[model samples]
Target: MKTIKKLSLLSLMSLSGLGLAQYTPQWTEAPQQIDLVDMTSFKSISQPVNSEQQAVRFHYSLLGSDQLSDNNQGYLAESKQYWLNTNAQKLSQGLQLPVTSDLAVIRINPLNPTKSSQSLNQQDITVQQFDQTLSVDVFADSEQLKATGMPVSDYTVAFNVHTQPGMLTLSMPTATKALAKGDTFIIHVFEPNSEYVLQLKTSQQQYAANQVVKINSQLLSQSGVNHMTIAGYITQPNGEKLTDLSFQQNKNGDYQATIGQLTGQSLAHGLWEVHTIASSDINGLKVMRDVSTAFALSLPTARINQQLAVQSHGLKLGLDVAAAGRYEVSAVLSGINAQGEKQPIAMLMSAAQLNKGQADLTLDLPQDLIRQSGFKGPFVVDHISLKNQSLMVPVQQLSAGIQLMPLGKPMDQDDLR
Candidate 1:
């Protein structure tokens, strides 16, 4: 009887309505967020006079993955980096240290970039575990700092806080000072490449494998931006740069780029790194902001309704996929208690009609289903599955600093009858 029960349990978790994972309802995607560490006045500590270590704290957010995986994956990990330097090197290079780990390649890995022959003040450092917050212990000789004219001269030390592979939570070029004294002096804080905060947005988080994805950019801080251009390449899981992509400001200062196989370009389904280079003219002073965000390229792309009100016969929606086949809409509720195998319950499926690769979809989500499943919070209209294709939306809400990675597949049959 015990063996039979175990078999039943495994079989129950294998349910795949609309080609979704058995644990679709068990997952939730939150909009990624970031916290920038202000190194300008964050802290000032003299290098330990006798090689004593001082710890500095860094706080952050949005390092967790939204998709469901059987493996226990997390954003935090051990890092041997977290530099405190005066060379004024770029933080983006620090971003690549985890993958490259080439101290020689980074160039700034040396204790002193000025090629000073003194090892006394050549910073001794220890990197610890990274979470939403982290601490680094830096040891510097006071005499060595004074020898280098530090606190009296106001030399700035920088840190590159790597949150994840492509996502950076906080990076302050001059976030802290290893040596600080009561006397005020020349504070050597290098200006950031670009003071403008640019955010990349898409119509939806997920897309079809061969879909022509739309790119939307917003200058959160629009000051000092006379003109700007966006340039970069997308890196595939295979360590390949898909192509050199770029975009410039239009007549209305609108900048955009369309990339995919549909436009004589190549974009496949997998995790991708989008490295962006923005050169903007601030008061005629051209500055550059080089950063990157990540998302997944998928198949059966569609538009998701973020703020939908409950209707009598479910909510009507639209999709940006080929409008040729019958589509099935599915959903999973959020903020509810998991009781038995019924928590992530699949609602009654609804059929969708299409016109020219567009969907006027209304999934049959009745009040009975909501009450039965104990769905107290919002519902994630997760994905759309059809006879020939399916699309997965990794996130339900579009918030600031969020990175999207949606997935899709072709050849689908109803997992739930």
Candidate 2:
């Protein structure tokens, strides 16, 4: 496997929170650790909603960030800003249905690359334009489950809005073993009686900004000529071309090239597809056909420098937004303790603005929350917000961390003392 493929695949396995992170509100039901059911986890489930509404009320996600490591372990956080810069056409078209996602990252001590640690947590279920009377519930609690790692079935979500009403509710089978297997997704588009078809494949669907998307293409059925060349272009979700992409043919009838570039004109977030116009010589005649295969671009966020200290009147938060402007930040707690008991705790609602895409601000946390939760340890803090004010499709640039303790030198402020 190539390096990029390995990392993105690893992230997919990590539930690296590409689509968004996970959440656990106080009201929702949570799974208990040490309990084993018929299987470890469910990869995919399908059932008609009990009501007319489809799968709108369902709330599910997992939080993954490289931020907490930067705060405590001196590791550099996720490269989200770079991702956005790479895919930058500011365009949103079509009124899709309700899209609601929330990522609340409870820290995972990667000490044992095998064993994952968990703290008790509370999260809210978010639903947009969703008027579904039916609710579908899957396993949302990855931390508290006996099966510690996230299941591949729960990691990815792919859908296509058809030309006609309704959709094909096809779900890939859950991986029987630890490592995921089989074709996770398939979108069947009927193109009958077409000639000179272009088929494209990539390393993976998910990519970070500035990362090269390894691509390979093959013309289905030789154009009846030994010498034929291929060329293509990338179209943004808004129907604008990011730029033109090209490739060279190898001996195996497959042409190889890198599909995307992080130029000023980006491929954009959301869905971007491959449409190719090939000029082929068929029996001394030129023929062309447009190939139809698409992939998605996802943005991962950067880390925020954060810390917590006891204040005389309340809790003081020192924050730093690494890159980009107008990011939303919030903090909360509630997780499993050493005794394996779930302890739901306080929330330090910290939402502040950053100037020049970066700044340092001292904010206040609810003093009452500090006393009630008795939080002397790390506080689970999540920093993420929608891009371009378009709520339907959000560009995720998140920083999830435990800001209170173990990040830096002992609290020097008098408040902690």
Candidate 3:
């Protein structure tokens, strides 16, 4: 009767999940967020030093500037490179330059000219706004004159213009001269005592739909300013303004803004931008600067269930999916080796489309791998992670490891499944 009872107990145990030990997944606290874009970047135009006579250089590498500069000419020749830097704008035909003072000095540097050193004279060179001709002076560029292959016409020409309060259009007649395939032009607009640097930053580049975003902007100057203000707004992926950002100066002397609890309500899932403008009154002159930073936003759509099972075939875990999406789970099978030291045996990954609700995913443990690891009784599942392939976002991770009991040997080829 005792033997019969023992046989009955064995049968009950065998009829169960047919695995070894059950384990509860131990997940890490607050998994590190993913980064889909650059976290921190800086862009600033340096002050030209001598403020009274400083000129903001607007340089353009037109047509073939890169090729003619190198012996491998035409190999890399491309169309004109427009000026996209701060404080300068490239118009349809010429440049739209800003003037901050009544008196300004302008310099034009022609590069890779087709004429001889003396063929193109400065008397023929002229600059006009609408229809008025401005007086100009010819000055040989010591740097270009020292250059081996540069023509004299390609040297620097300087001009002093009087009176200006707003934007200035510096244009050359369409019949002045045609540029060579490799030629370029330069325009230097002098804005005296108008250089102030501003830098913008964000805490991270990628944020979940429910996470808050933090931003900071810093302004630097030579002396000090009387009044300074900074403000910004958010632009959605569709190029529509979402909300306004109000920045307050903190104790650390940096302007900071706490974005939001990005929560609820369907959001446009893509790259979002933060555009800011900072203005200051320096020595009675109003200076303003604009800057922008971009970051990626994603939705959390899946999660790994804490209740996991250990079976002879492998490890089985449940997923509590919030949305229907292609989800993936991966883990490292680790166990004690012959030396009584724990080590990784095999890496396993499984992915499938899981609808919202409870779904079972299996991390098949190969019999050969288990046999090779030589674990005596119990094993472990380390570095387990669940990710949404459809949305390409990592939803959950368990780094503390799940303690699993040693799996029983496969019963045959059929058990390998």
Candidate 4:
């Protein structure tokens, strides 16, 4: 039985050749000590090369702190170097071939003797030859560790070698300002590697409650053009487009438009829909599909401009005119009672010039007319009518001040005598 055991051992050794003995080459005392606390305390050593085949060998030591060592001896009294054939047998049974630096882990417990240290706990350090340089990395168990720390505890360390290529970053542009209803916005995303299709998503806060508004939906072309259409409907009660809506083109090629006059008639109460649709222009045809969000429309107030006031002596006289033009203003004195009935009053004429901001008019009241009518205190100015025009403004509605000047204190005939 002893002879059979010896023969089996010899057969196994012969099959593996003497190279298996060199598989885990032992190392003597290393001269230098490494400090784990210093991250930069790393030393590079050349790996042994196998001439018979493409193989790499790594030998390393883990030293203890000088204060922790007995008799000031290093933590790792002796270390071993391990050889791995890069082109020889496969490291694992299922693997196709051996890589230059394939790492394996082994565990050992110095205190335990019944169990083999190989199965207890162990780490494999691989040295790989890449072109003219060597790469080294360590693997323990199922985890990988760098050579920067000792193997006494569970930790990860990594070592890498490669040429760094230039990098480019892409980012989206910030929104310019608050968007109004029916406004169009363009968004851009930059990428260099390949063309990408992106979909934009907006928050619920962007839309009104219970209102459906279409947000942005569009495809950005490689030319950086975002092709999409956005629109918002005014749904507030009496919501109308603002008057005098205009778009002004600046010297910088920017477009600005005043959202026309808004009236209560155009908008419905509550939430409105403001949406964007992204369409692709296939050939010349447009294919619009996606919709976005619901927005709210607020009611707008009406604006009033032209105003006037008319007064004669102490009684308020309502005057009607025959013609009113852009720059021409005319007023005719007429009689009207509280019942809105026309009474026969002496004909009076007043003239004024009208401009963009304000219209100034002067009414000369004849003393004879005032005296004959026995007009009394503080007369109110009634309606002011433009000559030959339909834009007749009521005197009560006029915002400008109206002054009644008594016709040049009727020239005294006695003074002339």
Candidate 5:
């Protein structure tokens, strides 16, 4: 009974068209709500440090959103008008960062009564420091408070803060790197989000085999930008343009580099690869970017030539033979000319039986056939077949005195004088 049950289980396992497995959700995070205050700033580190580090300031304003203001009541309705100013003195002392001489205005609406008291008269403050840590100060205008609402009613205004780091660098192995003769290599890049750019550069020699590289990129934020570009040089050993190399990106954001058939008589010995991506600067002038690495090339293999000859006769006409291998020979007897001309001649012999390097053949050329046909010159042979395979050889003209000799036999003579 166990044996029978095992056999039935195997039979069921061999059946096809089983139902597909269930798919699980790939994304789990909730979408972010749009912010009311859009803040953008540029910050950089000062070089050749002095006692006072370069001061960095932040400037921002409240953006009026028809969607956010829609259906607003009480305190929210009166806060949409007028430019909100920051308490820079209090913010500067609290954050311990320098305050710029200029005061930036934060715009707000006052007619909308639904505005919240917390969102009234807001201050936009920017802080500068040499250390990695920094803070932003937000304030609301008290004058924009609604008269009829609860004195302490709550209203929320979303703020988006973006920080741009300076002078970032990234490196990875490039596609142009040579693989060990029979092996393969994958070229790729590591990026935090779609807001970054990747650049790759390579030399001319590496462009020959560009099909082996792969790329993958993903966008993290819905508001982030995606961009890619692939470009490189095709220079010879002496630094000349053998060709131009270009690249294209696929749906997955991988750049495919391509170069047309290489031209120029001279060969190239050295190759280089390079690629670059310039991403959009969401917050400041210093955009996130990355570049693919470069690689050197190895030398190519040499070519080989093969040739053969037999018994000093040059093996002409119906007797032509070719060496297919170290010890294998094939016989060819007939063929057409290049000008579409046909040269038909009588077959004096055919290699009917062959063993090792030797063959037994039969000849049927009679004097009457040759004379009646008035076919002058050596008997021309075009092609020969053996073991279901055939080949053609160059036409060979034979002497009129030449006669067919039997296999493994000496020549017979009409006259030996």
Candidate 6:
């Protein structure tokens, strides 16, 4: 009676396609650490964008002495600019001038329907500095003045002045010919004394939770004295200041700071920014420079252990998750070929709802897939990884290969069709 019951169970398993051999994987060495910096970080859910509105296209470029010239063919390409038409262009906008005594040139080019880059001589455009009339110069054959898809050569104008620290209001009044709908206005500023520059840099553009972040900064000052004061602070995605960064000057003349290990759950997941400001008295002139840079942060919700085994179902992997979430495990299977070199045979993966702490994640390795490859064991598992599907974050990864002893009939040509 017992013999009959055992036979019945085995037959049931065979019918369900669950009858397979199980074996433990042998490890030749310890697993190596995975580099998350090489992978793309997951992006948060984006907000819905409203339909495009009929408005003027506006852009502004703030350039320094390094970019200004009498006739610049690549002025449009070389200058760093910002697009400000979030909804529509306004008739009047406030323009903040950088603090400098440099020979500054501010150009306001208004776009129109027919000619994308209309010369100031063709349009009655007005610019004011502190509500006063500002003198301007017009250039008729500036070839690089055209907007995208426009003719290569177009006419434009710029207002040049030896400026002190102040603000200017740029006015593009709406009229029959001066300004039109769906036009583009570009404001370019050139400062001759822009040789003084402050820079900020981070160690990496992305980091995992609980990882230490390093920062280095430097200032190329034309000032005679090193009397400048520089400081910076970090802000969360919400624009709230997280903490002030204290930078210490090193022997290499570089300002450096390190953010202690980020505590999981203490820091928010999103884009974080680092802002720096430097002020100095260069040649008795008060000069100030400020800049900001951003980086992406993510949580390490789970990790994969060195333990690997082959069971009746498939290859089993051990996972240690910090949070309860759906986790995925994948590995590359390689077997020894006739040349005594290990060659890739198959790629396997599996995913399941994993609870916090230790969990067994199995990847299905079909017998037929391996049999057809004609590779012998012991097999090797490489490029293994664990990821949290709920958060869309990579938990861990390993490139070091995991060795496994041969199971029943590691390779059989008879099994091949």
Model 2 spans > 4 angstroms off = 1-197, 204-206, 220-228, 236-238, 259-273, 279-288, 293-417
Extract clashing residue pairs from model 6.
none
TM-score for each candidate, following the candidate numbering: 0.34, 0.31, 0.43, 0.16, 0.21, 0.46
Error of 5 at 65 (Å): 67
**Prediction 2 global C-alpha lDDT:** 0.34
What are the runs in model 3 whose C-alpha is more than 4 Å off?
A: 1-25, 28-198, 220-228, 261-269, 280-289, 310-317, 329-350, 360-387, 391-417
lDDT of 6 by residue, 1-417 (tens): 898767776665453353234344765667644332311232332211122222221112211112112210111111111222210145334444444543565555454324533524523545555567665554333544454343432444554554455555545444334433465655555555566566677776555565677777666656422445778898876577889998888777767778965522212254577877666665666555666777655556666667777776577777666556666666666777777866666666777776677887777665565566566667666666665555554565554566766456533323321
Estimate, for each residue in 68-90, the C-alpha lDDT of model 5 and write its tens digit.
11111111010101111223222
Off by over 4 Å in 4: 1-348, 351-359, 386-417
Per-residue lDDT of model 2, residues 264-295, tens digit only: 11233346666554545555443333454565
Better of 1 and 6 by TM-score: 6
Q: Model 3 clash pairs?
A: 19-311, 117-152
User: Model-by-model lDDT, in order?
Assistant: 0.35, 0.34, 0.53, 0.26, 0.27, 0.55
Better of 4 and 5 by lDDT: 5
Give candidate 1's total backbone clashes: 7
The C-alpha RMSD of each candidate to the native structure, in angstroms, is 21.0, 26.5, 18.8, 47.7, 34.1, 15.3
lDDT of 1 by residue, 1-417 (tens): 898667665554442222222111212343222121222331231111122122211112211213322221111111111222332223311222221111111112223222232221213222222343333223333343467665522222323322222222223223123222121111121123223455555454444444575554534344422456667677764466878766656565556666875211112244566666555555444334445555554323233432233334344444544323333444332223453221333423454434444445555444444444453433444433322121222212222111111233322223222
lDDT ranking of the models: 6, 3, 1, 2, 5, 4
Candidate with best lDDT: 6
Flag regions of model 1 displaced more than 4 Å.
1-195, 218-225, 262-270, 299-330, 333-382, 385-417
Residue-pair clashes per prediction, in order, are: 7, 17, 2, 52, 58, 0
Poorest 10 consecutive residues by lDDT, candidate 5: 72-81
Cα distance off (Å), candidate 4, residue 94:
99
Pairs of residues clashing in candidate 1: 39-175, 207-298, 208-298, 208-299, 209-298, 209-299, 323-357
Identify the candidate with maximal TM-score. Answer: 6
